[model samples]
Target: TGKAYELDFNQIALDPVTGEEQGRRMWGEVSLSRENLMPFLYKLHYSMHIPEGFGIELGILLFGIVAIVWTLDCFIALWLSFPAWRGWRKSFAFRWKQGGYKLNFDLHRSGGVWIWGLLLILAVTSVSMNLNVQVTRPLVELFSPLTPSPFASRTPVSLDEQKFPGISRDEAVSLAAAEATRLGLEKPAGGVFYSPEFDVYGVGFYTAENDHGDGGLGNPWLYLDGQNGALAGTQIPGTGSAGDIFMQAQFPLHSGRILGMPGRILVSLLGLAVAMLSLTGIVIWAKKRRSRVLSDQRRRHAEPEMQAVS
Candidate 1:
């Protein structure tokens, strides 16, 4: 049928209008397609394509640990960049006149010094993204209050035990729209999503064009209970405790979407700079290792000669 329908994890598609089976598509068949490239890359960034097992996402945990290490490394790098107060300006200057290894060293140290703040922001936000419940949320809550997360509040059921919602997606969207209006929100209902595990429906407030939430603190979302359509929680960005606002700003700040197209462009360039710094850092390390090895070899040869002379 050409009519609208909702697909479940079991590969069953049901028409909300008729409450009848429409058709079913294999889950992998639909997901593993060319159109899903962006979504695949997005997941890869945070999860590294690791499969979930034993109720733990190993990929996410691994990257979260990496982010924590990277955050600490940023501060250490900054300190190492400035060796003395007498010539602190050297940390920010590039040795453009002397190219090759000197330039590479300068790029690694000076380039890092120039954009150290941005790099730190990215590292910290990566941790927040991967370890929100485990680390970020708890840390944020220590200083400021946070409304309970709807996803965390509910225990997720197994796929076989998934429950279908009593109200339709349309009804949930309407309820959310009404709530948005009552709360003086200006945006229209953009989309609706159902969580089979948690049995909750979330209606996002935004336009189709702004679905990615390019500007500001991103869009607001209303979550409702599946069984009775009761309001479960609301995430109206820019309106919450200090910690709540900080948490809301994480993705926008990390992706540089807070500044819209210009922000995205800057972030793209920043990524290139980071790659360059890593390459230069490796080159510097290799050259030093080679010199150290040669010095050790010479020292060993001289030690035998000195013993014989003595």
Candidate 2:
């Protein structure tokens, strides 16, 4: 960061003749280009050893999940409504006698039983979406650049002072991203702060949420080991592309977490279903218990008098 100044994209940034801004936008433009994208991705995934079309397949899988999640939603709704259907099995469930409405009775009670397990499975699996990916994926791709957040064995990481003597904001950001790739850091994201007075480069990495801070489950950042080409002691969680601070941030934006925004709204609806189902299930179970106890008491009272007389 530097003193705020207005910049013209067309003149200062895009124009070939503009010397200062040309290099700046060059990184920005290619930040997502086919030429440099894969390595930039490698820096994040930490590897690139997958089958030829694995990345494209992964994209397909991500798309496939949308349909899967939607299907899960329909099942969840069916499951939650099961208790109301089960009420039909009761003598006066649904405010009428199941004895008289046999077809209606089966519709409520049996239909719900069929979908209940399926709904529960979907809910649990959906929550595991990110967790499963996080816990297992990066390690699997430790040697594959296609994976997110894989670290390299010989990455330059150091804890020395005076390493980044003349490094500025841009240099610091580049070094952090480069080291992250070399060292196999996963899904790195952060901002760059520059100061001529400090004459040192500080590149902070974290989640897009801006929650990644020093030792706070925050994004890991590194102060350039100015003396040597290594990262200093700062490990924020998550990684993004290398090249430019502001530009690489876009991919992270697409990840639905720059704002700590929820991944998808599917889970939100699922949560509502869970709450409703839980409450209705408890009520139905309670009602069934009371009915069974009453019936037993009535039977015992009816048979006792005759036995005593005999």
Candidate 3:
């Protein structure tokens, strides 16, 4: 299947070699294909190769918890960075002249302090992405009203009970295109997606090059009823309530695509910084622990000497 097809998800089943419409394939069959390396990696990043079983997505839940912990740790680390108000500058200063332990400590503490806001954003957005329904939506709703998500608002049917769309994919796209034009959106319909669980068709509008809707709140998506092809809901980025917009920004912010290429570069560097900080932290802990153990051993040896002398 070296032949490239259109970006429409509607034709996901189209055999590129034979030019025949094949039935829908499983996610692994498509995502794990030779041509879909990025998609496979993206899936691995969030899901960590965990398969869904027993009505639980363990990978998502575990990552969500980790994000929550990371979010709280950010605040704790910030507080620890400023132990004394007068010497607070030390927290942000790197001891470049003194290498080894001092430099490691400085990198771990100062590096984190320098990019604390970005770290917090990453942590919080991670939670939003991993646990939108379980945690983020509830928390956002506490402060601001959120427009109900079409996928979440509707009742989900089991795979066995899933109903086929009454309207064709082309019909759904046409309805979505009409809605996009009505709203004065200029971007063409870039992709079409169907949710079997919710029985909804989501039509995304953007340029081919900007499929992810990089830069500024991402792209607009229209959710249509699969049965009637009627507009069910709309997600026009940057055009909603405070809570709604915040919810929409989660994926873009998490992936650092909100600022486009520059943001992606920054996020990649930040990832390295995070890794460095974690390694330095472990080194610091090990050094301290070793020191404590040596001190305790010396004290024990001295106690025996003191007893002998007595």
Candidate 4:
């Protein structure tokens, strides 16, 4: 249903030997465009892809910078919109008798105050997700040892160098379940992927930490030997460092998966609020520009009359 997948070259391909672009087998179909819509929004919303050819990383970098700037502006807007002690209550409520301009201004100002925290969270999480390696990851890792160093010796066995035939898929999964149980994980489920380059089985599992929804976040993972089903190493979410926890929480917080249905509704409302604020801002700007032009015209007409009187 909600799974996002790419073409499985190993299964269905035009030229398996050459590995050229080919058709794919659709494993399942959704009732709507849910599968395609998410990726399209993700790519466009975060500036991950424009023309869809090249420079995706560069596009993300540029958008990451813009997000940072926008977040800063949001902070400034929050500071500026803060109501004084005398007007604090008034700031929370809109006055209908104050006319259109005041209504628009109050709605714009108060609605912002209402959603600033959500906006800030969205902005921070967006930056972290987009600039993971450069900014967020490093900042997170500064306090935690979740991510392994690049120079660390994995010494993983390659799939081709197997001494004996590899274990069956079911056996590998059994080992993962056993490992999960040994670690006291609740409701553990795992899957293994055969990586040719490393010659290892990458097994990832969901645990209690991921009890909320799909468990994409806060999942423990490990590498297993494809041949003998030996447990190479494991990363447990329960004992993960602060950085690991923060990074894991990012997706859930961004997508409102942590809070479930109500959380999703709130996020959707926040999007509408942002759009409303943007439109009101444009209207305000246009009205100000019109007023300025009319004032200038009046001043020019009065200037000649003043000159004649002088």
Query: How many times do residue backbones clash in model 2?
Result: 32
For each candidate in turn, give its C-alpha RMSD to the true structure in angstroms. 4.8, 17.8, 5.2, 7.7
Q: What TM-score would every model get versus the actual structure?
A: 0.90, 0.32, 0.90, 0.70
How do the residues 142-201 of candidate 4 rate in per-residue lDDT, one tens digit apiece?
677665622133454433443443887677788878877887776556445666445456
Judging by TM-score, tell me the better candidate of 1 and 4.
1
Model 3 clash count equals: 0
Candidate 4's displacement at residue 287, Å, is 2.0
> Where does candidate 4 stray beyond 4 Å?
1-35, 51-56, 83-85, 96-99, 142-146, 149-175, 190-201, 206-218, 223-238, 300-310
lDDT digits (tens) for residues 168-191 of candidate 3: 999999999999999999999999
lDDT of 1 by residue, 61-87 (tens): 999999999999999998899999799
Which clashing pairs does model 3 show?
Answer: none
Residue 11 of model 3, lDDT score: 25
TM-score of candidate 3 to 2 decimals? 0.90
lDDT of 4 at 310: 100
- Which candidate should be chosen as best, given lDDT against the real structure? 1
Show the lowest summed lDDT stretch of 10 residues, model 2.
145-154
Give all candidates' CA lDDT scores: 0.90, 0.46, 0.88, 0.69
